[model samples]
Target: MILQLIQVSKSFGDHQVLDDIDFELKEPQIIGLVAPNGYGKTTLFNIISNLEKPDHGEIMIFSEKNTNEKIFEHLAYLQDNRVLYDNLTAREHLAFVAACHNVEQQEIIEICDRLGMSHYLDKRVKKYSLGMKQHLLLAIALISQPQLLLLDEPLNGLDPSSVKLFREIMTELFNKGVSIIISSHNLYEIEKLTSNILFLHDQKLIRNTEIDVPVDYFYFLSDIRKIETELTKNGFFWQSKNSVEFLFTLNECQKEKLEEICQSNDVLIYDCIQKISKTEAAYFSLFT
Candidate 1:
């Protein structure tokens, strides 16, 4: 394990936030930290990064045990707010990070270019868009060359185009053997990028399970009564194609239900077989 937490806990004055939370990170994989809002995802990241220490339990890293806290040695954390020096230009921000880790300026520029933020290199961070700000924060994390990367809502405020670009960049980094733990409200993006899940619920870890499916599952919806009526006649079960559509297989006798209903109701079938979006599945699964 690249990172491990043995019975971690934290609190804000009297209220309990994270209680008995035990989690770990294995190298060469991406881990999605998911839960509803206020479940302590950000707090966990803060503890691991040493910005906030846990009230209880031990946090252990594999390679550098018993090391000093001044240098995290193998952990890099990115806060949700894109916490950068607001007055500093992007280039200055990049240069400061590179100097901290002794990474060459040339390499830093290459990373900026890869993230599509090269043009904003000379502009102050306060002037950057939310997406551009995220890009810059991610670049700083990359400079450390960490064994464990902790990201809190890294995709929080990105546009579709930037989200796409961010996914690709993170994928490349994961391929290069960086153990990543990212917290996001965007489960669609999370679904595409992760194999294992660390589900946090009610301020503690409720489940930690590896995904069994191919990350591609069918999502659809038909009227429950209508689908049931059709399925009952045709002898099929409800099969959702995606968010907007559903498909049900029926026996020959039941085949007429869908057709009859559609004709009688005059409701056009918008879709029957669409891709199941990650958010839809995650939302459904959270309840189950």
Candidate 2:
């Protein structure tokens, strides 16, 4: 296995963050880590990177026990951009990393070129925009040529073009046999990257696989009681409702028929939203 976590557990005082977390990633693939804020996502990444020791657990990487120094040889953790130094140039930042990791300077240049950062490689980080800093952080991570990469909110503060660029870079790395675990709040972006999702909830890791299924449409209305029979007869189920509107889930094929029935029954349709993916639906189901 490329990485394995056995019986991982961590607690701070009385609050337990993770409990008996066991996960394995054997292939070169992308994994989407999903969880709410303050749920120890960063803490888990720290433990894997050896920045924090687990209260009780063992971490194995590349078929060997991971040591503090040795793991950095093959594992790259692209943490928050706050770690970047404003006084240093992008070229200098990558040069330092290359020197520490014994990576050739030429290789760093190649990575910068690949990531389209050659133009700003010599520019001071203090003058760089958030998107530029993000690109530099990714470039620094690539300098190590890591086999296992952990990225935390790498897409944050990036523009639409930058986001697309980042996605392309991730795809390229995966194609080159790099196993990556990305934690992001962007569900739509995650959906495009991988179907393998790991959700952290109740101090446990839950694995969910996204599969092909019929898309569900949620209709919002003032009151469904008047047309509840029409909805149930057509396989619609009450999803949620509030003072403003009630929401119900129906098959995409039933949208036209539903509208027809609602029009005839005087059921006002405030809005109708086509659900994107089951993963998104599952995420909303947990929080909403």
Candidate 3:
């Protein structure tokens, strides 16, 4: 195990945040931490980083080589609220981080180049965009070479291409035996990045199970794509509606064939989210 939390607890005033939290980190795996905001996910990261003392319980790890000597040495956390010197140029910032850790200047430059941060290295940190800042932070984290890397919503504010690139980098890192722990609510991101889910509900882990994408009716998606052509060719009696999500009424045989096609395409029907119905749920979570 890389890291373990045994029955951890924390509170402020009368409000309890983390309640008897127990979890472990295994190497060569990417763990997804999913939960509502203000549910103590970040708080737990703080505790693990030794930023705050736990009220009770223990964070235990097996004694390994150089493990106890630097309990935090193997842990690197990129908090949601990013930290950077506003006055420093991006290159200066990277250099400063490298100096702090005694990383070679050549290695720092190589890391910046590899991450596509070279062009903006000379730009002032305050002028850097969110994506650039995130890249810089990730570079710093990688330089430290922590066995366990914890990121809080790393994909926030990134463009689609950047998100895709970041996912690729994460996959590459995991392949190299780096354990990643990320907290995100974006199911699409989770579905793409992880095989198991650490489903957090009400500040306690309700489940940690394999992420199963429910099977979708196979031919349904194909039929929808070629609806006009298929309609004229098959001469089937059916109805269609497009108020919001795609809707169709097909007879038994058509429905069966559609299911078969969709299943073959790895489309999961039950995972489809109906946004109109979920609008209320979204509003309450955001405003209430």
Candidate No. with top lDDT:
2
User: Model-by-model lDDT, in order?
Assistant: 0.70, 0.83, 0.66
How much is the lDDT of residue 14 in candidate 2? 98
Q: How would you encode candidate 1's per-residue C-alpha lDDT over 1-288 as one tens digit per residue?
A: 777788888989987888887766665788888776777788877877767888888777764432356436677888864478889998898788788878897888788888888788899888878888888888888877887788889887788888888788788888888788889766667887875667676667754443222123222334444445544575455555444555554322344455566556544555444245434454456645
Model 1: colliding residue pairs:
219-241, 219-242, 220-240, 220-241, 220-242, 221-245, 233-254, 234-250, 234-251, 234-254
Those runs of model 2 whose alpha carbons end farther than 4 Å from true positions after fitting are: 210-274
Collision pairs in model 3: 217-259, 217-262, 218-259, 218-261, 218-262, 218-263, 219-258, 219-261, 219-262
Q: Model 2, 238-277: lDDT tens per residue?
A: 6665654545454445666778887988878888777566
**What are the per-residue Cα lDDT tens digits for candidate 3 across 178-286?**
8888887665676588855575555565434322222212122323443444444655443343422344334346556555555665554442322322222332333
Who wins the TM-score comparison? 2
Q: How many residue pairs clash in each candidate?
A: 10, 0, 9
Estimated TM-score per prediction?
0.74, 0.78, 0.70
Q: Which whole-number lDDT from 0 to 100 does residue 38 have in model 1?
A: 74
Candidate 3 residue runs with Cα over 4 Å from true position:
61-69, 208-288
**Sorted on lDDT, highest at the top, how do the candidates line up?**
2, 1, 3
